[model samples]
Target: MVAITNTTSLTFLKDELDATLSQAESALEVFSEDTSRSGELKVCAEAFHQVRGICQILELPAAALMAEEMELVAEAIGRSVTPERMVGTLGNAIVLLGRYLEYVQLKNAAMPELLVGGINELRRSAGKPLIAESHFFRVDVTRERQPPAAPASTPRTDVTRLCRRMRHMYQVGLLGVLRGESRTSLKLVSRALARIDRLCGDAPMGRLWWVARAAVEALLADEMRLTPARKQLLSQFDRQIKRLVYEGERALESDAPLLLVKESVYLVSLATQDQGLIGEVKRAFSVRPRFTDGALQEELSLMSGAGGSVIRTVATALKEELNDIKSTLDMAAQGAADTDYGDLADTLVRLAGTLVMIGQSREAAQIRGRADQVRQWRNGEVDPEGMDFHALVDDLLMVENAVATLERRFAPADDINREVRNTRISLYQLDEARMTVVGECRAGISLTKRSLTSFIDSQGDRMHLSNVPSVLVGVSGGLMFLELDRARAILEGCRQYIEQSMLTGSGAPVREQMETLADAITSIDYYLESMEEHKPIGDAVLEVAEESLAELGYPVMRAPQPA
Candidate 1:
């Protein structure tokens, strides 16, 4: 019944998912104490409730059931039940729900034993006392399983041996569960905890030991269901065990604090119960192939077909861009209407792509950033009667020098445009402060127009109420720079459009209206810039400005006569 009818739905869902993860992470921190108990329960309950709705929309009832169990677990803990009794089970359930969502064949529904027994197991663990002190038998770890052992709050020996032993059982068991060896995995988890109980004695490790033991018992009672979530949880348990063992071994070698090892052992035994460790475990590491030599060879072979030296070929291409830049610079200095360097931004980006082909990814990234800076420089301000292009030109020259030096070329650029160099020094003296203000204002408005156009195109029909604030903010920011009051009146229409889009699942149904307002703003920008430059607005721009200004209920636009 919860249908994602539009693109905005997924965006909203991702936001909700982000919030749930955040709350769960917070609950993980203080879920242990009675003091933070109520607060933790509230966050967990809210997250679970949100997750339930998402799962329902995706038709994942099993995942939903898992979330519901956690909600109930938190409620149980709120009313005097122990946190150790419920933490592991709830953490395990979250892992399962995540796996269910990442599904190959998402099911309509299924009531599994794991879901049914989770709450019951928590109640049973919460009611059970610390094991009797006499159960701390010194049995060999290889021996078969035994019944419940006694517990005590007394640490008698070093936990090193126990940590090493736990390391093995937890890892092997974690692997076993992943490969569907459920009984063996549960048995190993149980064995590891038993060893912890024997070694930890009366220390805080016993409480964590019980938490671990309870987790194993819960799985055994529910038959250790082979869900992806269960496997992931066990994997996390395995990683923590490995960390615990490694830390123990180092501690033993360095004669470090034995308490450190005991603390680690306790945490390992508790696994996902701690939240932060579980988060680390959830971060899957991967190896993505990058620019290996073979890839570089392939690129070399392709570009080599252009016939000249590779460095020369690349340099030649770069020089061509410089030539075009010089002309744009001249036009900018002359205050030409067509002095936009949007093409220059595109050129630099394309040049960076060529660097990528040569396995110069680092350089490519740097070049791309430099390209972005070009737009950033032009963002709020533009240089009309363009100021000196020396800084931009020098940056390009440095790239050429680095490349030529790497290639061991001694000769300088044979084709470097000296015509650009001839008057470049004199050009920087132009007092274009007034020209800059007018040009920048026009360029800012123009860029904003393009931004709106791009937004409407990309959002398609999935726009929602949430998107309006971004647009309104952007509009206000740009127009405020120019003292335009029209931005406020137009905002009401934006609000109405957002409300309607939510109902109809159509983004900005009155897009033309928005576009017209943008055009009007741009026309005003162009008119002001032309006036400041001591030139007449062209008839083409004047007529469009006249119509747009009148449409937006602004003052009439009369074309300024030639000076």
Candidate 2:
């Protein structure tokens, strides 16, 4: 749910913000001429409402409040006494709207005192006054809880659909148990818990809250101490939750605690069973198959690295400066230098921080000192001292050139980075693969302890060995390309351990093998994290890993050993 919804919502949100800003600016322009475009003001109000709705759903209070304030100004255009007096105030509101959009995009923007004073003056003229000198950062948070009138955003899937949908999870659970598919059954229960967490998180319902709390704690539990067997049982917590679902049906029906948790996943088996549940409840439980063995993190790391992460850090800092410089450029082209310095102050702080991150503390300190020079200017637009644009403009140009140079320097190379990317993807695929292998290995080991070893396959303890794709060959090249030597070493050892201990026939007791695989994955994950964080990896660590593997009987290492 989170995966699909956030991706789509963010895109939709950016579009709405852009459209709303356009509408507000157009309305302001129309009103600036004669202050008599009541119809245009209404259109702007509708646009503001649209952006406000999407921001509310995203739980971004600051952006939503800015939209609300704009809506109020538009709503007052024709209705207020002396409506002609509010054009300048409305123009300030539109600019503030633009600043808020930038803030939402990268989270470093701040409201200028000019914008604040303008909004407060608008509030006074409209007879809808605000608190004097309200702090922009804290204002929206206090007011976000009060629900506004139904907003003008796109239509959404109703939260009221959860009751009938949750009823469907019960039958899915029963089917999973009947088929002896323990993992499937567990994920089924997990999907239910996700729903409850989304809908009834911290609700007053006693049983429902109890179920939510237990599932959350279990999901967040450390995987180091638990064997695969115990980890498999985490899904069973859903069985105890069945009763709570039934009792809480009334709460779901009444829409007492409304919410949208995540994206809906289709239930394939139920749809095929002629219960016609395929379309009905499939999306009700989108299971992401949480693997505690760090495969998920490895997959995520494919996109993460100092190359990409640091670039984002640099881009975000430079973006504000880019915006301000563009603003100054526009004003200078128009022969209007009397503008505001607040954005310049913010940009300097951001650049200093970015410089510090990139190991240029001296450059950062110089920029921080230069911020005092900038303060003598008006809103960072023009110098108040004899119009000294030459020195300030030169410094700005130097920073711009620095941004361009860093982008070219730190940008990832295609050949090696491709290997890093693919390796991460393959590792994610290996997460479920490893989970299946562990399940099969555990099933086989359980058989030696039982009399009916042959009957296990029919009982849903399926042996999943013959065609399981080996992670070693698939990702080894990529790992090597990334210079994740320690991870590559551990992965090679894991490949050998699987072949020797578990793959020839029906296999052996795999407690040691599963532990080994888990340990190898953990070590590799640490190495991957270190690389992403741009931290130095010690020379001794891979040596220690090799020694550990040799002790475990796998003749493997990422690099050659001494003769």
Candidate 3:
């Protein structure tokens, strides 16, 4: 696995790396302007070479590989290749790398797998064979793996014929997958792999089949996307089947391909489903949940879009321009001779072009049409109260509303934060009830903590903690009202601990037990606070509370699984 540690040396090099990337982009732009300046290509290559060295020094394998591919693209351009065809790839690489660095700095950890798509794009542009998506995915292929049980019925006498039939089954499913019939087709593929696993039981090749089975389960669960690279990986599995059909039963004893096993294990790790074989694989590999493919793509979309700061700036400028246009339209409506409809027409045309550039195609078209009408009006005698003039003013007002909406949509982050901070309790009955319950829960948790603290201080006095059970019961009731089942469950466990352990046990609670109970209470308090603030309540908090409750020997029941 690629480590995400950010060292002092990496931090120190970040600014210089950004400057070098900028220099490379500028040189590429210059070279695009005049191809004869082959020297600019050399400059670009040298910059990328520096970037590769820096990434290598930092032990950023993926980033170093990206820089190497970028250098290759630059050199390819120097060798009389068309710069236009490759500049976009190079430009995207530069921008994406910068954004990724910012992402790492902000998140305090790197997920280099997220950069695979961009890296592959650079490699493709450099005419290099694409790397597997699981290139960074690590797993021990040589580890012992148990295969699925063999069929209880009579064994197949002709192994080659049986294997060939299974291969055919796999091919049919592969066709469905290739044709985009994923959900059903994935089952067929998985079923075929299941048969193969049973056939290869206790053989070295069975591990590959086992992993592939889980990988397909992941795909079927929609944990991963059917990307081009993954499609190729699936195709490679067909060759594995052919090996078994052609080479006889001994082929089952052949060692599984290391890269293939790693990729399959990687897919299993991405799976959200934790049931049966997939769950078994995760436990064996000690895999933890990371970003699913869908979540990763969403993050990439946000990073690639115009930054909030830039959007807010553009929105501000657009509103100012809209105000100017509105003022001119107002003057025209009032029969002001200095209205200068022709000049207004020019301004509207420019505004429309800006709208188009900002991805507001419909708005651009409307503005452009209005501008054309104003151009015609400039040549005619004007009537201040004319329907034509009135309609133009109304349209301008509509456009003003759109500009206002855009401004709000892209409001500055600080302004949004301030607004949230200033938000007052709603007078609506449902919201008021929810907040009231949350407040009650918070106070109850506080009381429970104080009672527990006093009980610990008193060295086993039931009098100090007598009311904790009732207080916890009230909190659990309030949590149920708020529809927070998880928190209520934790509180239920806490109530049990107070009633059964601290109140009735022969001795005072141990220090570890007291701390664990305290931790559970604090987690619920935090949950209630988050609820009142209208912030998202993450599952991690519930997990912490649940784990603490379990440590206290009064574990809450697991939440109900979704149907």
Candidate 4:
């Protein structure tokens, strides 16, 4: 037994209890006139009843006895609470109890001065009018005690130990709900059902066991409403739950308890209704799965159904761009500038938009920039000497074809194996095309550079010849130099075109092709350096071009040593 150290502590407790009681009593008076204020009266009455418990715990018999009567009055008023009488009785009870609670708290404080202002405020409220029936107030000198009675039902065999075993499963189900895990929640519900089955036994507290089983089954069915597969799983769980409940009753050898059966049936019906409501809500609001793991496939399927037309339109555009690029390239090769590549450009732009729609922004930006450049160059003014008209057309058409092939290869589809195989084939074909184009460009630049060097050399040699007239030599040499400069400028423009093509197609690994092009250009520069008398000017230009191309993954090749 615990010993009470300080009897003075009880005085403080009594004072606090009185203050709470007083507050309850004051509110009761205000509520008495209006029966519509019964809700307020009920709340005040509950406070008074709570104060009564605290008073009894502190061993203040007088305060505890008064509190017990107040509780009885409060309970009576709460049952048939009318505005006027409930307010007068219940409200008054709450005020008196509130004051009593406060006085007890004040006396318990280490310093009485700490509650000086508080005590005064409580006293002011306690002065308010309350309905006091004199006959109900009886103070008895004698106290009687009675022995505790045994409970009608015995406690079950350590079922709380079973709850401990299933604690993780319960948390998993709860957490799954918070995380929106439809399948995972169902799985947890299934585990909970098994745990409940293991714990069920012959006990007076069997109703709790039946209720828990029914609740878990209901939860399983509810969680499954998110997906068709889970719904089928729920049907299986439902049959099992019903069978389990039936067996438990049969083992009892009595008419199945109405409470267990009624609750089980009610929950099943509620689950069915809730499942229908979930389906309706999903359909009405167009709810889709957001997480990527198992939910991605479901969400993609839903998106395919809802936005099939938009996806088809993008596929059609890609196919058209492929055909247009092929046609344009053939026309360009024949030196025809009349063919409009605008359709290819337009398709590429739309493809970029489609990419963005499907969540591929990085790839989309590359396609968009290439298409925009092609469109702008086609429309804008061109430098007569600097432009390679045919090469420009070829580069644009190649970019269009490459982008279209990429789209066809990676567009989300049901048959991913076939698509992946086709993508690999397309990638191989694109690499071949890139190499062929780079070779043709290098050849064209080399031939033009050689011709320029030959012209310059021939004219310079003639001007130095003693047999030729000075005026004629000057005129021929000047005309030849001008032609040589024009040819060099044209080759330089071809180099720029190759560089830009490499930059645009940088997403593809074409470093080998780029290196080959750079090597060919370096060969042309070496030939020019050996043949031309203006070595300094040619060498400076060659160095800059070499550095730029090298940075673009075109390093200079080393000469082979003797074996």
Give the candidate number with the greatest lDDT.
Answer: 3
TM-scores vs. true structure, each candidate: 0.21, 0.25, 0.52, 0.24
The TM-score of candidate 1 is 0.21
lDDT of each: 0.47, 0.46, 0.73, 0.42
Clashing pairs in 1: 96-229, 131-151, 132-150, 132-151, 135-150, 152-202, 153-202, 154-202
lDDT of 2 at 377: 60
- From the highest lDDT down, the ranking of the candidates is 3, 1, 2, 4
Instruction: Sort by TM-score, best first.
Output: 3, 2, 4, 1
Question: By summed lDDT, which 10 consecutive residues of candidate 1 come out lowest?
Answer: 132-141
Q: Every model's Cα RMSD, please? A: 32.2, 22.7, 18.3, 34.7
- Which 10-residue span in candidate 4 carries the lowest summed lDDT? 140-149
lDDT of 4 by residue, 1-563 (tens): 11234446666565565566566665565556555566655656576677768756765444454555555565565565242443344443344434433444443422111122222223223343322111112222121111111221212233343333334334434344443444434444445544444454443333333443544455555542333323333344444344334454343223334433333333333343334423332223233322221233333233223335555466566557566666765665565656455765676687678667766677567677767765755533433234554444444444444455555544422111122233224443543443343344344445544543443456422222222223223322332342333224323433443434422444432433333343334433432322221111223223333443454444444335559
**TM-score of decoy 4:** 0.24
Candidate maximizing TM-score: 3
Per residue, candidate 2 scores C-alpha lDDT tens digits across 1-563 of 01223544555667767777787778767866756556787887888788788767866555566667768877877776776666667666666556545544442322222234445566765677453222321111111111112231211133334333433453444344343433333333444444444454333332232323333233223222222223333333333344344555444333212111110111121122222222222222332232322432232233222234757676666757656775764675466655556566667777788778876677677677777776676543554344456555545555555554455455422212222223113322333444443334333333322322332333423254332324445555556545555556666775665556556536453333343343344344433332332332333334434544664678563457569
TM-score result, candidate 2: 0.25
- Could you tell me which 10 consecutive residues in candidate 3 have the lowest summed lDDT? 414-423
On TM-score, the stronger of 1 and 4 is 4
Badly placed stretches (over 4 Å) of model 3 are 1-12, 80-83, 147-157, 305-563
Poorly placed runs, candidate 1 (over 4 Å): 1-157, 243-563
Better of 1 and 3 by TM-score: 3
